[model samples]
Target: MLLNCDLGESFGAWKMGLDEQVMPHIDLANVACGFHAGDPDVLAHTLSLVKQHQVTLGAHPSYPDKQGFGRRSMQMSEQSLTNTLHYQIAALEGMANVQQLSVSYVKPHGALYNDMMNNPQLLKWVLQAVARYSRSLKVMILATAEQDKHRELAHKIGIDLMFEAFADRLYTDEGLLTPRSQPNSVHNKQALLQQVSQFHDDNSVTTNTGKRLPLVADTLCVHGDNEASIMLIQDIKQLLNT
Candidate 1:
C-alpha cells in the first residue's frame, strides 16, 4: 500500500512535523494549504520537497482553526464550506504550479475529515467542491465497511475517492476510527507496527474490542510528528517494501 502523511503544517515561528526527515519515506503528501497551519512559504518548500523525493502531492485543507490545529469542528453552510475549499485548494494548486507539481488529490485535515465521514451532506459538499475545482482530483477519505456507499456518492458527483486506513490509531467495531479524546486511542510504536503488519498481511485491523474488521484500502496513513514516529514510518516503509 502507498504510505501518506500530512505535511507542510508549520506556520511562521512554530514548526510541526519533521517534513525533511519524513518526506523521503512517504509516497504521498497531504500538504496543509494555509488554513490550519501552513503559510505560503511552507507550501512552496513542501512542494519542493515532494518534487525532490518524487512523491505525489495532495491538498490538506481544514476549517480555519489554527489554534486548535483544525481539530475542532465548526458549523458551516454548504456554500460557505464549498467556497472555503475552493479557496484553499486553488491556493495550493497555484503555488504548486510554480514548481511544476500537480496536486493529485484532496484530503480534508483533522476535524473536517472526521465530520465529513459521519455526515453524508457534508461529504457530498466536499465532493462537490472537489468536482468544481477539478474532476481529475480524487478525494482521500477514511476506509470503512460502507465505503461502497461513499464510492457511489462520489461517482454520482463525477469524482473519485481514495480510501485510506490509519496506521497508528485504534479502530472501532463500527469501522470508524476511535476518537482521539478516548484513552488508548493512539497506539505505541510496537502496537503501531503490529497494526500495520496486520493490515499488510490480512487486509484487516483488530478493533478496540478485539474484533477484526475488514478494511480494503488503497493507501495507509502514517505520522511523522517526532523522532519515534519517524522511526515508525521508516520501519513501516521497510515492511511495505518487503
Candidate 2:
C-alpha cells in the first residue's frame, strides 16, 4: 500500500507541480532526471526534501525528449537506449550521493515504460543497464496478472523488482492499463478512492466496464500532473492509514 508520486519535473524555463506540498503525503518520491524534466538544482532540492521527509527516493528516467515531456515515443537503437538510461541513472545517482541519500528504485517514465511492457528486447536492455549500474536498486513496474517475462529476467539478473499499480488510471480486462487515448482512461477522485478501497479490501479492482480484476502490487503510483491529483493522493493516504 505504499504511495508514490512523480515529482521534480520542473525544467529550466518551465515550472511543474507543487512538490513541497505533495512530499508530505507520499511515501516514495520518483524524481525525474534531466531527460524528461528536471535539472541538477531541482534534483538536489528534491533529494534534500525527500531526506527531510524520510521518503524513499526513486529515479524516473525517460527517453531524451524534453519537448514532449517524454510522453511521445521516440525511435532509438538498442545501444542508444541503453546508453541514455545509463546516463540518466548516473546523473541522478550523482545527485543522490551529493545529498547523502541513495536511490532506492528506478521507474521508467512515459513512453519508455510502456515500451518495455510489450517489447522484450527493450526490457532486457533496460534491465541490463540497471544491473550494470547497480543490482540493488529496485525497478518499479506496472503489475500484470500473467507471468511477466521481464520481471523474471529482472529477478534472474539480481535486480529487485517492485510491482506498481496506478491509483488514478483505469485498467482493461486483459490486465493492461486502459489506453490514455480513450475516454475512460482516467478516473475521478471518488472513483479512484473506491477502487483503491476495493483493492485494499479484496485485493481486486473493478474495471471501467465492471469487470473484476485481481491485482497485487507492492506500490501504487499517483501522477503529479493532474490538477485533482493532489487531492486524490491525500484521500488515498488517509484511507490507507485508516
Candidate 3:
C-alpha cells in the first residue's frame, strides 16, 4: 500500500513538480536520472529530501530521448537499450552513494516501461541489465493479469518484482492501462478518490470499460506532471490511513 511519486524530473532550466510538497505524504520517491528528465544537482537535492522524509528511493530510467521526455519510444538495438539502462542506473546509484543512500527499486519511465511490458526481447534486456547492475533492487512492473509472463520471467531470473497500479489512470477490461490518447486516460480527484476507496476495500479496480478486475499490488503510482496530483496524494494517504 505504498504511495510512490516520480520526482527530480526538472532538468536544467525546466522545472517540474513540487517534490518537497509531495514528499511528506509519499512512501517512495522514484527519482529520475539524466536519461529522461533530471540532472546531477537535481538528483543530489532530491536524494536529500527523500532521506529527510524517510522515503524509499527508486531509479526511474528511461530511453535516452529527453526531447520527448522519454514518452516516445526509440528504435534502438537490444544491446544499445541495455547499455543505456545500465548507464542510467549506475549514474543514480552513484548519486545515491554520495548521500549514503541506496536505491530500493527500479521503474522504467514512459515509453520504455510500456515497451518492456509488451516486448519480450526488450523485457529480457531490461531484466538482464537490472541483474547485472543492481541485482538487489526490485523492478516495479505495471500490474496486469495479462502480463504475467513478465513477472514470471523476473522470478525465473531471481530478480525481485513489484506490481504497481496507477491511481490517476484508467485501465482496460484486460487489466492494461488505457492509452494516453484515450479521452479519459487520466482521472480527476473525485474519480481517483472513489477508485482508491474501492481498491482499498476489495483490491479490485473497475476499468474504463466498466469491467471489474481483481488487482493485487505492492505500490501505487502518482504522476508528478499532474497539477492536482499533490492534493490528490494527500487525500489518498489520509483515506488509506483511516
**Which wins on lDDT, candidate 2 or candidate 3?**
3
Residue-level error in angstroms, candidate 3, position 6: 0.4
Question: Candidate 3, residues 1-242: lDDT per residue as tens digits?
Answer: 88998999998788999888888888989989898799978889999999899899999999998899999988988788878988888899898988899988999999999998777788888887888774588888888865567677888888988888888789888677888888989888888888888778888899987989988888888755554767777788888777
Across residues 1-242, which tens digit of lDDT does each residue of candidate 2 receive? 99998999997777798888888888999999999899988888888899999999899999999999999888898788888988898898888988888888899999999888767778778877887874468888878765366567887887878888888789887667889899979887778888889877887878767989887888888766655777777788889888
**Model 3 pairs in collision:** none
Q: Worst 10-residue stretch by lDDT in candidate 1? A: 128-137
Supply the global lDDT for candidate 2: 0.84
* RMSD each, Å: 1.0, 1.7, 1.5
**The best candidate in terms of TM-score:** 1
TM-score of each: 0.97, 0.93, 0.95
Query: Could you tally the backbone clashes for each prediction?
Result: 0, 0, 0
What local lDDT does model 3 show for residue 62? 96
| Residue 37 lDDT, candidate 3, scale 0-100 | 95
The residue ranges of model 1 lying beyond 4 angstroms of the native Cα positions read none
Q: Rate the local accuracy (lDDT) of all candidates.
A: 0.92, 0.84, 0.86
Lowest summed-lDDT stretch of 10 residues in model 2? 143-152
